[model samples]
Target: GRRALVAGVADDNGFGFAIAKALAAAGASVCVATWPPALNIFLNLIERGKIDDSRRLADGSLMTFERIYPLDATFDTLADAPEEIRTNKRYAERGDFSIEGLATQLVADFGEKPLDIVVHSLANGPEVKKPLLEVSRHGYLAAVSASAYSMVSMVQRLGPLLRPGGSFSSLTYMASERVIPGYGGGMSSAKAALESDTRTLAFEAGRKFGARVNVISAGPYASRAASAIGI
Candidate 1:
């Protein structure tokens, strides 16, 4: 049986959850990696029955998922993280859900097994509302780090955990190719970089690991993360 790991789910309303559900419906054991800070809220919503898991899809099929994991990609390992980032107010609240933490948990539970599929559905832009000219270096880097480079980082860290011929997919936006005025800050540039890196990763990872990498340019949808950018 195939196993899938989905990254970047904030809630059931997001694409990550939908993708996870779809994979589960297809009989794949699906695991999700939610943003660490929002993992509790996601669990609460599921526990409180706020989102219906039995809802029908367009094809009249029911939705389901296996597990959800906490993930924060800013730090690959707890030891590699600086004290300030570790002690930051928002980060401190999530406990140890960093990339290394999840990797450790996955290995502990699955015993060094290789995953069949990996989905990159995470993105963020702290200063998305600000114009590019007014965006600060920190905000620009944050956008690139969260939205674009995270995919590269994930492939670097998790690629070894994927079986040969495994498939990796990421969700991109049209903003990479066209301008959307309100989509300011360095987000557009970030998307462009993401698309470019996707191609590079596809070639490199495919050759080295015998895995395929691709990206989807999804149509605009009002997702929780997108709403934060007022898109």
Candidate 2:
């Protein structure tokens, strides 16, 4: 069976959750990575059966993730993570959550060339409600780091572990090209960068690893994260 890893699934409402169920239906063993602070909440929702209905597959079987790991994409390595983040209750015992850490852990658990699919269904913008002109430099850079550059980091770390012809994809938005009021804090810029990188990465990763990279510029949907933008 093919194996897939979906990063940034925190709730049943998002594209990552849907991608996991779809992969399971296609007979793939699926794993997911959730932001550390949201990991406990997401697990509790599952354990309490709050998302049971969302787990149903097309074949009537309930989709189950083979594993769920803590991930904080802002940092590429444990060494890059600040001491405060390393010691946070949600993170302290979660083991390494960086992209490099994830790649190493996956290789250790499943051996080399273990993954057939990788999905980057992640986005975060701290000052999304503020206008772009009003967003702080800190907020803008943080948005780009978490929402855009993380994909590049992921591919850099995980590309070698992907089987030949493996696929990598990330979600983008129309706001990447067109202005969408209230979608501020450099999120639009982030999505634009994600799309631009997709083109270059497709060529680079394809040539180097025999893998493909793509992005989906999806229409707006009121997911938990999107709602914060008042969309």
Candidate 3:
């Protein structure tokens, strides 16, 4: 069986890492796509043996990743990224490491239909601490683009990359429905779009590629991702 690509895994404590751990424990080979800026840091932590104990399995043995790829889901293509970001020191080694580029890299590395599952645990809200009324248009749209459209873009790009009966799932929050006081900066709207696209993608992808799409509405946990709410 091919490996599952778990995108957005920056550290051991995030939902992405936990999901990857669960998949590996269930007998799935797991590969992770990490943001280029943080990829080196993550590698250093793993190499220096500074790993987190929370990632331990029930049997007590630590999990391992089959492979790691640099990825940034915010921009589908390199041309869309800013010049400063493209020229950054951390991103210099990774060529075209966006979602679109990840698909291309996977094909070159594993041939077509290489993934059985894609876990999209990516989300970013620049103005997450700002209230809706205080947020700028750019901030609101950025949240939607990163948190919602990234999933849609990945589904579109991975249609050929996913094996038959493959599945793609993303993480959402309860803020998509009932409003949480501090879940501001249009993050709630972003989750709403993510969930809506999940349902739509399920039908569209299932019909065309024999694939499935879904989003998990996760509750609050101590993962680094949840800390963005400024609690």
Candidate 4:
């Protein structure tokens, strides 16, 4: 089964959305894992038929989802979340919706191995507007954890959920290679680690799980988090 679970589609205009559309056009059943805060808005947009026309397949059919699940890559497991976040109104209905929770849910719904493609499109630079020298320790580290390690965490948890010959991918940026002004905090460092880990994970996951791991360093586009850069 060509079933894909794309994590991090905050909106219809992002790269994640494009990847989902392409997979659907190729006859793959698509499901998305969205950040909880954006999840409600995204579903509302779909319910309102806002992007129905744009979801058309090459064969003149509309691409649809198997289901959309709530996911927060920041917390690897439900137990990893803080008490405040656990009881927050936004997270109440998400149901232990972290990386590990998602893995368990997948198994419960689809079985031991159900995925053909797993895409990690998550990136959060909370202090993107601040200069590197002025960034707080917590903010800088948070950026790395959210933007880089989240991918690693996903691979570790989702590897067993992917079938042999399956693919695991994450989105990165050119900032990993060169110092881009206005892109400060630890965002660049995070992307660099993400690229580095991608190579290492390829070897580990390929050898252990028969899966291919890769990173796509796409250029800048106006995704939801773009405005936060204050560029």
Arranged by lDDT with the best first, the candidates are 2, 4, 3, 1
lDDT of 1 by residue, 1-231 (tens): 888999988687778877887887787888888876787787887777777744456567655556677777766777766898778775677667777677677777786864889999998888989989899999999889888888887887778778767988999888789877878779889899999999999999988777889999887778898778765
Write the residue-wise lDDT of candidate 3 on 1-231 in tens digits: 657999999888888988999998887889899989899999988887788575577888878888788888898988888998999989878888888899988898888878999999888898988988899999999999989999999999988888877999999998889868888888999999999999999999999888999899987778776766644
Instruction: Give the per-residue lDDT of model 4 (tens digit) for 59-153.
Output: 88888888889998899999999998889888887897899999999999899998989998888888887878888899889999989999889
The deviation in Å at residue 128 for candidate 4 is 0.7
Question: Each candidate: what lDDT?
Answer: 0.81, 0.92, 0.88, 0.88
Best by TM-score: 2
Candidate 4 worst ten-residue window by lDDT:
222-231
Q: Residue 91 in model 4: shift from native, Å?
A: 0.4
Model 2: worst 10 consecutive residues (lDDT sum) = 222-231
**Model 3, total clashes:** 0
Predicted model with the maximum lDDT:
2
Any runs in candidate 3 off by more than 4 Å, and if so which? 52-55, 59-61
Residue 143 CA displacement from its true place in model 4, Å: 0.8
In TM-score terms, candidate 2 sits at: 0.98
Positional deviation of 85 in candidate 3, in angstroms? 0.9
Residue 176's lDDT within candidate 4 is 83
The superposed Cα distance between candidate 4 and the true structure at residue 156, in angstroms, equals 0.6
lDDT of 3: 0.88
Q: Distance from true position, residue 226, model 3, in Å?
A: 1.5
RMSD of 1: 2.4
